[model samples]
Target: MNAPAIPMIFSAHRRTLRLTRARHRSAGSDAARFIAEDMIEDTLERLAFLRHEPARALVLGDSTGTLVASLREQGAAVEEPAALDLEAPHPSGGYELIVVFGLLDAVNDLPGALIHLRNALAPGGLVMTHFVGGQSLPALRAAMFAAEPDRPAARIHPLVDPRAAPGLLQRAGWKDPVVDTHTLTVRYASLDRLVADLRDQGLGNALAKPAAPLGKTALARARAAFAARADADGKTAETFEIITLTGRRSLAGT
Candidate 1:
């Protein structure tokens, strides 16, 4: 894919998301769906098998605060970053376990970011991450096109294709890197609600230069297009393909 040409994500965009964390926490239990609490829970399940429970863990994006809490419940010490800028280089060494949630897609340099994550781990330390991936939001994309058939603006951030992930992991020097994806389908009553959920989940526009919001007339068309695709249940379907990655700092050295 032509990833480099696309300004994947702006650092400032993430700061806004972090600032809104309180709003997400107040959205009630159902907010988990938007904040990806399920994915964090799923990944946490695998921690049952770790022979070494991490004493110093760094959590990159736990907007929901679920993963960090879960780690703490295991009697492990967990710390979170005050601000995480995916475009910048991080310190080379610290932390034994790093569990990232919902932050990778906006990164401008995937390879460098991955290298930083690998380097952040102490020897024998592990890094696990999840983010929305390539096969995501086809319905929303179609609606955007219908909104402005003549000239559709770039609204969505460029996402990582799972197919290209393994090679990237290896290139970053993560030993025995693993990458996989699972699809989650959600149905929305209207396009507006979908957009609201995205904002509530900190998945709002993170592009370096975001397009202007749809004009009044264009929005009407996009809503109509979205309604046209609704199933008999009268809800439009949107798919999110969650990609998971895991790698470790090797005792044997890279």
Candidate 2:
């Protein structure tokens, strides 16, 4: 798995495992798929503005092919990125619409990855992406920080900043890029369940050098501390800051 330039993110190959698991164990089934589905539907709607059906479409980081299946159901041809070489240059323009979801946060070389995606698109083609980033899990982060203050090597999963989206796209030769964000809050019956869900979701803390595995004493301490911060209803709050991005490359220009 390629390490992303951004610290603490999962590797590309491992992301599928994470998302698939997350999707499966998602406590709020509806909310779990909300972001991914919303991104796909929105991207499709935007591509409709182009006034023609794209003959070739590419879907990046399409683990389990939910989006790919949707596109195929729409009668569009789809190519998935997880099966390709992340370092390879994008193939000559063949796709008119390219949608990458939940991947930017994990790829080791985001700019390089975007450039490849850009190269695969036909002139004037559009590329849309949604990724987990930008202070998405502040509460969880805060708890971790409180649990271990001196663990600088400890890293949680890395997320992209919405503010960095435009620059990243530009560096990849994507013009007229637009990036925005939204927040999602998820709940857990208990701090323990929440942590379990995170692990099942493949969002296991990937800190560069996390503290020693949580033994019974440490685990109890962390849990008690987390519960102390729980809301009146007794549910722990988890935030996910999602970033939505869109960009285009001129015909034969990129």
Candidate 3:
């Protein structure tokens, strides 16, 4: 499985995902561990251009305190983020903005989750959900197949395509739905470093039934296959595609 793909049609058990994300809460810096934080900040900056700033904000799935702090620094009264269920709508509905930092891909019910987010917002509020998508890390995926050429179990989640997001947003009753994608290319020295970076990003296995780790022989083959893709500089390139979905809760309930 490529490190950059998001779990779109995922059989991810919610408990497993929660457990995986919990590690970040007690851990130190999340820098470079994942790419969503930086993208979230960028999206916020874009929002600022539209004169959009939250008076009462809620940030879901924030691994670090930085985003929460940033909201407060901007004078928004923000509710501290947690590993809350996206399908379950919050009873309170006065938030001017809601940001889902890194958990939308693995959700069990994408439309239901979006609806819950919409319902949790006050009229004219905005919700922005970010995740990884598009064709990411083809080399890594090929290497994984080389690891178990015959019977490779599923490990990576197939993230939702950004192209389909606008329709989904409309189905969920989001007004002026917007969906966009950004790409980042990173070079790595070895697969080990790549795997480490993934774990650091709180991207451990969240599958309902995760495949067992590859045996030593299979791992060796995987390493060799991965190494074969290295460039002249002895580094391999990986692509990360970030998808952002933004919409407004309609005042007229459209």
Candidate 4:
């Protein structure tokens, strides 16, 4: 029997467009990059702790280029592909280490993507993947809801849940899989600023069916809703939960 089809919720083209726009917006050194920086730091720390150095590595979705530079500094030959589709099989394989940043959250067939990543690795090779988790962006979510209280649209891309990652890794045939999560809290004075930060970090929505842009009245409502959550200092706290998944292909090449 044929397997069930994965839901077509995200558009690969839209995802690419969002990333491209984010790259353009975040080109300057002064742009917001807390998310990418955090992921890179955690990944380097893990690699150091494991003492697993790879001769050849593939780094994906590293918009800031810092991760690639760091890996090269570590004496690894890194491949930073211009474009890669996670939902499909990687063009090449036999990589010793694969690091994916911030792209997995928008993948529609996440399980399949994991399998592809695993397949692309050589025996005993390591893969570290990080993306925003399901618990992220509560403030933005609330504001979007307020924009259309009577009929809310899908304004945010659904993210991966940390709880489900281990199962996905196991199903993908990864050995000794690990799932870790950490939250980053940022205070924003307004909803527009929060949205700008997200765009700067390539966290914009990439749903296949994007909601229409909010009208003037709706924008005011969203701003008000977000402001209502502010503290005495008039800044709203927003949380971004980052989930990291690490695993290795079996030595037996399973």
Clashes of each: 0, 7, 0, 0
How far in Å is the alpha carbon of 247 misplaced in model 1? Answer: 0.4
Superposed by TM-score, candidate 3 places the C-alpha of residue 9 at a distance from the truth, in angstroms, of 6.6
- Estimate, for each residue in 1-254, the C-alpha lDDT of model 3 and write its tens digit: 65555444544465345435544543755435457466657766877877898899988766656678888999999995445767677767778888876677777678888999988888999888887775766767888899999999787766678888888899999988888888878898888887766655555556666689989999999889988999999999888788888899989654
- Candidate 2: segments with Cα more than 4 A from true spot: 1-13, 16-32, 48-52, 91-93, 196-212
Lowest summed lDDT across 10 adjacent residues in model 3 is found at 6-15
TM-score of each: 0.90, 0.79, 0.88, 0.98
Candidate 1 lDDT over residue span 138-252, tens digit each: 9899999999999999888878999999999999999878897888888999999898777667677877777998999999999999999999999999998999999999985
Model 1, residue 144: distance off in Å is: 0.3
Q: Give one digit per residue, the lDDT tens place, for model 4 in 51-148.
A: 98899999998888888998899899999986799988999999999999999999899989999999999999999999999999999999999999
After aligning candidate 4 to the native by TM-score, how far in Å is the CA of 19 from where it should be?
1.8
Cα-based lDDT at residue 48, candidate 1 = 67
- The regions of model 1 sitting more than 4 angstroms off are 1-9, 13-35
- Please list the residue runs of candidate 3 whose C-alpha ends up more than 4 Å from where it truly belongs after superposition: 1-31
What local lDDT does model 3 show for residue 209? 67
lDDT for predicted candidate 1 compared with the true structure: 0.80
- Which residue pairs of candidate 2 clash? 3-108, 4-107, 4-108, 8-158, 123-251, 136-241, 155-207
Better-scoring candidate (lDDT), 2 or 4? 4
Q: For candidate 2, give the lDDT.
A: 0.68
